[model samples]
Target: MQRRNFLRAAAIGAGVTAFGNTLTRTAMAAPAQNGPGPYGPLQPANANGIQLPAGFTSRVVARSGQQVAGYTWHNAPDGGAVFADGGGWIYVSNSEINPGGGVSALRFDADATITGAYRILANTRLNCAGGAMPWNKWLSCEEIDLGFVYETDPWGAAAVQRPAMGRFKHEAAAADPVRRAIYLTEDVPDGCLYRFLPTTWGDLSSGTLQVIRAGTATSGSFTWGTVPDPDGSPTATRNQVSGAKRFNGGEGLHYANDTAWFTTKGDNRVWQLNLAASTYELAYDDSLVSPGTAPLTGVDNVTGSSSGDLYVAEDGGNMEICVITPNDIVAPFLRVTGQSGSEITGPAFTPAGNRLYFSSQRGTSGSSSGGITYEVTGPFRS
Candidate 1:
């Protein structure tokens, strides 16, 4: 039987999902477990530029170049994640600006009200999409040659860079709790899908980096090949490797229900990989599915909802957060109007799962210098 079949069987027949002793029996994404219908049409957010489903409300939590409570909110805010704190949680966001780029964190109360904001990591370059770890930390990635992934403490503690994860135009990463592995995506036209098998689970200091070779669509077997040089040297690591499979601008990554989901911006496709068997299936392809059916374009950042649905942020298209159902039907979940050229990013949820958070990489100005982080509250799935 195919790997996907095995996963489905284990999830249904045994009433649990398991992945290599790393994962415990847990709920599938909220959308998949509770949904088959798309979200309702969007209602105008305001002249400040945002749209969302009825009953849903949004508020700006942080903005570029602004000072909040003695800390400066950095420019070009990109990928981010949320971690549970005492009564509330901490939201850490990446600054995609060069030279001065870094990561920032915000404190919120149980009511989703912002408490304070501060910078966590600094003096980096192009910190882009990153993933939250099972160990309660954030991996901030830089989009540059020999770029490294930084493990940052969400509480403004110390940060250490991990080059063992491989160096290239890094885009995003997702950790498979069951497999104890970190899956990564690159942002080049011919980027690759990779995974880092840490010498010890939950430790990013040492790991073996390998890239995946694609098989067929929706049900292809996958194989991994070692990355010659994880830290790009005289010659960039990606260019030095041979026989490594390439993806079209690999972008956002997330893990749900024993599967690793990633997006490819070049072709606007999202792939679902079964971690145990290392196999993948195409989840959504905009090119194959016309705009009339699914208006969302330029698929970039992705986040999974407890309802088992996936929310995708557009990098250039309608500037909307599109929802992808388990059945693969697509519809607009949230749209940012008046921001013609900017993209929506950093979609995350608080630990209690009551609030949804995201960012506009570029605000109404449509320039990198202008960006805003937002939080939305509604009847989110439990």
Candidate 2:
């Protein structure tokens, strides 16, 4: 077996031994019950610019261009996921810049301070957003032409970039172990949602790529239209792209409850794909999605909370972490402070869901030290 697969199996086996059942089985057996509402609005941070609720605190986990493992830091750090390995924190972060900053495999002590950071893959182009694997590694994806997905070890070695998944402008990826497949997002005009069915369950290299078909039109015959078109006329025709889309800038991806939730930076919409049923549904249309007094806007990245709620990071507009409750009410769960006018991305929860971590990139109106990571501690009432 490949070292990656072996490590994954061993981790799953250990989890099974500890829990006495499969992770998904336990999750489905007892659905998460809703807790109380969020703990008020976000509290502003001090000089560090980290923000959380009243009871919670924020600290610097790591910074850009910082030296570690004999290599200097890179610029434009983007999507990242947290993994638990024998009681340690393993952070897999991406560098979104061209000749992509490369993936960073960092080990943190119990206090969440960076102990070591090393390059996992080098000389790659535009390593954008990625998701965490169930067996405990990170799926690093390239977002450039003919982009590919690389499955890397938590320790930053033994890497393979799988191109069979697709060759378009790939953005982000989310793995669904229950269905033994993966969902991918493409950043292009009239961009299409895709799924990869692995030939072997839990193995990512061998898979078939398929695009999503939606709208009232039949398959392979749908067209794309601009958002908020003044004409109010809908265009109908297959808007498929041979390689790139004119406007669809696909970005964030997350899988939960057998469905894949994704976001498009161009249109500001959150879509869901029912994997088991092979159907598409609109979870939120940013053009029309209004949560409480705050309408959903400028969504960048998204992740599932332990209570089954989805927390979306807004990269534009108000610069806040918005939570979409089970009832479809969108509100500001955490408003970012310190770095005003900065864009927030990557809102991932720890394995235990006791803490939430997010990153903020430099924006148009503010001067930032590259980016900042924050930890929010609370009940995280979904």
Candidate 3:
């Protein structure tokens, strides 16, 4: 098995979602990243205007409207994930530009050098956060009213739309291989958490979408109810299900080790859903930070390393990617100093876990046209 998959498979989730526990939160992040991080303190801003730890270096990989090698990079780059290729790997990113949003991919050599760049999906609208399937396809979602999810080929094949996943304001998708279900998040105040169970393991052509039976449930464990209409007709899919638990502005999601971790940008919180138990809790809550200092806010776009460290990027706060250890300590791993106006997005580590890639959706100009993608390399823990 690949080292990355092996690490995740070997992880033991801290599941507090026992069979008889009420819907409650477990304080995982204390003081909101005020503790000493494994990476130590970030050094002063370097030439790239980034504050990374000692021994770590940053370099610009691509910029909006600028040609990366040959292909022009897209604007408003958002959620991203990495896929393993023959000798190297590929990094796929979503473009959050309206009217002409889409997805793009960058090819890397085994040495982590960019070999090529190209578009994967196009002619879409407001393409936002997405999930990488075990089957190696990218589920690019749209963050608009009645949006859709497009499953695009990471290797430049034609994209296919999968409306069976629902047509609400989709933000992000997380596939749970253990349950053979795809968990989805809506980008609304009262949005619902959904799961699409395909007829088969790898085929997403058709499926039964269900909503979490929460909100009003006063039971030890929660369950899911069928979404009368996955098409989301007159009655929106979210509204169709009564008492479906609402996630405030859900932005990013990632599933591993039988636990699914997601973020709510509106509340500046990271949630933990124990798929094995069907119960969820707060992994990191800014409001619960001790001494009232929340180092990690604007919680968005979550990913984990093979070492079991959870990295949550900020959408607005300090433009930092805070690491939340399995032990629950949260601290800044890196920071973009001069791009305070731009939000961080698409944080993903390479398959070997040596290089980390992400983008500043608006860069220094703080406009959609000024997106800047970056790569950081060093002695990473995993």
Query: Which candidate tops lDDT?
Result: 3
Candidate ranking under TM-score, highest first, comes to: 3, 1, 2
- Judged by lDDT against the true structure, how good is candidate 3? 0.80
Q: Clashing residue pairs, candidate 3?
A: 33-330
lDDT of 1 by residue, 1-382 (tens): 2323111111111111111112232333211222223657777666556787777788888888888656788888889877877778888889888898889988877776678888889999999999887777889999987798999998888899998998889999887757778999999987888889999998999988888865434457878888777877876666665767778899999775577878998887877777666667666777556435556679998877655556888998988888776454577888888887688888887765568788898888888878988888887653
Best candidate, TM-score-wise? 3
Q: Compute the lDDT for candidate 2.
A: 0.60
The TM-score of predicted model 1 comes to 0.89
How much does candidate 3 score in TM-score?
A: 0.91
- Candidate 2: residue pairs that collide: 187-250, 188-248, 189-245, 189-246, 189-247, 189-248, 222-237, 222-238, 223-237
Error of 1 at 125 (Å): 0.2
- Backbone collision tally, model 3: 1
lDDT of 2 by residue, 81-170 (tens): 777756656666677777555677666666666677778877787777887766666777887666678887777668777766666667
lDDT string for model 3 (92-124, tens) is 999999899999999988887789999999999
lDDT score of residue 262 within candidate 3? 74
| lDDT for position 254 in model 2 | 78
In model 1, state the lDDT of residue 265. Answer: 89
Provide TM-scores for the models: 0.89, 0.78, 0.91
